[model samples]
Target: MSTIPLLASQLVVTTIFNSIESLGFSNIAGKVFSGEQAEARQEANLKVNTKKFYARGLKSLEQQDLYGAIKNFTATINLNPQFAPAYNDRGLARYKLGYKQSAIEDLTTAIELNPYRAKYYSNRGFMLTRLKDYTAAIADYNSALLLKPNLAQAYFNRGSIRLQMENSLAALADFEAAIRLDRDLAKAYFNRGVTRYKLREVQGAFEDFQKAAGLFKQQGRMDYYQDALAKLRQLCY
Candidate 1:
């Protein structure tokens, strides 16, 4: 429910839509088959309907209509229960609606349906962190990293959790990894600055805060930019 996790959820939804669009489902009937033409046709129709409902769900999410998104995502799943993306997206909608346990369950089902997708694990990890299940959250983040080593968000989330646990050194490592993967990730720099400050690395912290402020300004995140500047001022003066 906090700003960072909410942003993560939004990013995940955007990634899900991008993945769906990139797949380019063209009529579903375009794939020719030799046998069971009638069955194939039915399946194709179902796929098309599933995609339509999924699109509606995504639109609802973009509109910040959590209930509508959940409804349409449920329709998408009803049409195709094996659709991993639908479950993942519905989990996010559920989280936005404060259905924490239900969101975790949906995300778990998504992972079960498609274990290779790193974002599902990352999404579940964020929810678990909200639930204060730090151990499970760390495991999920670890799994996400295993599936996609360059996932900056997973590293950032894990770093945040580690920082909460007062493991500043480990958190710093994760934040550094996140920044390595995504130099423009202002949050990562800000958090790493925090971790470095905690560890008495004052100069490093100052540099990171300065970089974070610059990136946040470039990204139009005025609130974060101001926050980073405040931290820099605190460090300097």
Candidate 2:
């Protein structure tokens, strides 16, 4: 997988974990009547096991064990079919495994299960963008931003698509918004530099490249650092 998609997958995983509190079985908590005690216990067990497998899936993903992550996430979904996060995470695993079409299908299911979650749309948008469906990808990003206006990654992703479409001015605006929301986003600075260069803003492009180079080096992204330095060299001449 390319760097952008890998970064987007990391963002998706982080977003899911951060929002985990909102993703659990909220209906599991009510008082159970005498006749329903057995059923309630089974349900509770299912929830516990589902969470256990889900956690394992996340651990596998963190360790870069893609197949293990997929297996665990599948177990999570089987235990709790309503668990949208499992499908979302499984999709990411599938994407990394090069099952792009299947990955999109899983992400679609996640969206169907929980349309209110902004990250699902954003995740799907990344997949669609990879498939070159720029229009649909843009629509997904638009939906994500509408649901969560402060989504810096969404802005950065949309800017990347815009840059690819050759809409340098609009791309510059999106990269600027992303940078405003997250100053540490090295890729946003790099893309904004590219956008500025396209627009003939030489000085602004040079500064963004320099910033991106420093950020990439600090973040231990030596390949990106080299690319940023190449941009600086191009600008100097």
Candidate 3:
């Protein structure tokens, strides 16, 4: 279950990971995108007006000015209704502002506009999980995994939802998939350990917890290491 929360965080960043989209456009940008693409550009468009909307929005988010960031993203969305990235970016800002429902709407529109993009589904799934819509969230994650079969993050997310349902064995399978894809996934290790413990596989739990702590320490995530250590000492050790 704890693993589910961590997976949700990782999946939520899918939208932000490709955050640079629609950030650096200019009138000259049209030169590169000809025909319908060039003629489709909107006047007073945020993409052409300036990169400031995206940059400023990201900056405001980093500064904890969540409302300000949302405003900037709003400007972006108003300027480019068809801009999937703009919608996704706004969704992220909205999510941070605790506008979960609004974020879901924005992200949903984003996915509809850009159905081929895996990140959109991942982002939507992240929010759905928060909304406690586990079924929809897993469906979205599955959509992403369908496009990118080896996507460790998607596996991690699905594993989390399974964990929430107390399906530890299924959760463990997904965690193992994630680890096999990326051995450095500390979250997967910790989560798999928790799942193993719940399944009464004590020795396996101990090994996983120990490895998770070591991996967290290697990544300079001391809080994670400390937490894992406490759990290991109290339960696994």
Candidate 4:
């Protein structure tokens, strides 16, 4: 699969299963037990099974066992097709396994199941960028930001896509927002420097590049630090 830039560190999937106990199952035990009691029992059983499979999937993902994670997530989905988190996690696993189209489908389903989740939109946006669907990706990023204005990753990712489109001013705006939200985001500074260079803002670009190099060094990202230093040397000297 083509490697795509991650918007953030791999988003933890555990949050998806956090509300399993609340999903009420259909009561099949009608007359023998009260409807409420039957439903409660069914829900409890479903929660146990779903949690078990979800936990297994999470462990597999942690081990980098993409196939194992997919299989377990699929089992969890089969038990509860409405489970948005399962679809989100399975989508992530599918993306890792190079099933980009399938991953998008799963993420779309997850969005349909839970439109309020900013992460779902952000995840789908990242996948769309991988497919080179820049317009759709930007729209998804917009939605994510609308839902969560404080999301630094969304700003950074959107800035990256803007940079690819040669929208230097917009890209700079996004990178600035990301930096405001998280001053420690080295890549945002680096990209901002690149955007400033594109706009011929030499002094600003130089300052950003220097800041990026210092932050990358502090974060132990030697490769990024080297790249920043190279840019500084090329521009300043």
Candidate 5:
């Protein structure tokens, strides 16, 4: 019914052409159109296109049109009421539009619909973190970790929450895990550096600050980098 089916068919053929060719078929395209079975498969796939709406939403998100993405994602959810990603993306769109409470409800529903999705929990945790519900944010981050243990961002967010609570040891552990998973997280380095400074671990603090400063500079966030540098000077100069 839409161009999306064409895209999906192309994707499927691209991934499985070799196997199809080996089965006495000249090519996937030729074999795919040779019989009633193939025609029926295509018809079924074309009709089952809640995913196409979801894909359109993702494309809109990539274009930074949050409202457009929300519209498409909402359509996808209407097409298939149980689509978790559509709900998740719609929640994100609502958040960007400053509908904070609605975003929270949508994200919460997404988490309920698919508790195993780490991104849903992670996004909800971020919103909760901003809302100053550090306790709840920690719980959400913990849920994400349970689903995807190696998720570096979840550790970093959890670390931030622990840092806010002044639980420096726990925060440091999380930041360390985050750094292990992704070395490029400047915020992790900066926050960890601050925590180390509070703990009187001067060398550790200095190292973290230096790394964080470089990362900040790379990101063009020079003001914070300057602050970190000033702190470093106060620590060692």
Candidate 6:
């Protein structure tokens, strides 16, 4: 049976903490020397300001203000060029605002700044997937999984890409791994159902669709719930 692939493209966010301590200026408000001491005080003030700007950027991101988030993150990066989280978040904001290539560049910069962050690779993989760069996207997902073995979203996304490539068995394995790692991953169940149906496992598909529909309803995702229900109906009749 020829199978049609359904892919999901949702960008996931990562929460990161800044390592720089916020040094309050109260201690040096009145007493400050020249030369190296003056330069030290200036550096301390910049770190504090960088923290504040980074916090504001995170707040704006939470409030769904993409432009505000970008502006604040840019300030944070200007204050501290090596701050990887700022670049990562700015990339997220750019991606949301439809600046896909710029988003990818920001993500790449973030990765260069901090290669240990698994989420950075996953995020860039998502942008690559949107651009239909399946091979590169898979490589990014592979890197993410290698860095963090329990990253369920990476598995789900890789499975989605594999499905698109007509590798249904590999897709099924990835979806299963994702579902095992995160039971609440409703989309994983839904996609696994699609994979199962393509593999002629009608009963498995029916069960998966039912589970996906229930989970989607619980998550308040009406569109996905309706789609799952529709798939179930097709299997039933």
lDDT of 1 by residue, 7-104 (tens): 88888998887787689854344544434687888999999999999999999999999999999999999999999999999999999989999999
What tens digits encode model 6's per-residue C-alpha lDDT throughout 118-228? 999999999999999999999999999999999999999999999999999999999999999999999999999999999999999999999999999999999999999
Q: Residue 94 deviation, candidate 4, in Å?
A: 0.6
Q: Please give, for residues 1-237, the per-residue lDDT of candidate 5 as tens digits.
A: 555445877888876876666786666555656776878977677546887888889999889899999999888887777778888899898898888888889898898888889999999999988899999999999999999999999999999899989999999999999999999889899999989998989999999999999999999999989988987898877
Off by over 4 Å in 3: 1-47, 50-52, 235-237
Off by over 4 Å in 2: 1-33
TM-score of each: 0.81, 0.82, 0.76, 0.85, 0.77, 0.83
Instruction: Give all candidate RMSDs, comma-separated.
Output: 21.4, 21.1, 21.9, 20.1, 15.1, 22.3
> Model 3, 1-237: lDDT tens per residue?
354455777767865655545454334446666655645765435467546676777788888888888888777667667878777878888898789998999999998898988889999999999889999999999999888888898899899999999998899999999999999999999999989989999889889999999999999999999989997997833
User: Which of candidates 3 and 5 is the stronger one according to lDDT?
Assistant: 5
Task: List model 4 lDDT by residue over 1-237, tens digit each.
Answer: 998764443434333343332453333345547877879999999999999999999999999999999999999999999999999999999998999999999999999999999999999999999999999999999999999999999999999999999999999999999999999999999999999999999999999999999999999999999999999999967
Name model 6 segments beyond 4 Å from true: 1-34
Window of ten residues with lowest summed lDDT in model 1: 26-35
Residue pairs in collision within model 5: none
lDDT (CA) per prediction: 0.94, 0.94, 0.86, 0.94, 0.89, 0.94
lDDT of 6 at 109: 96
Cα displacement (angstroms), candidate 2, residue 233, comes to 1.8
Model 3 steric clash pairs: none
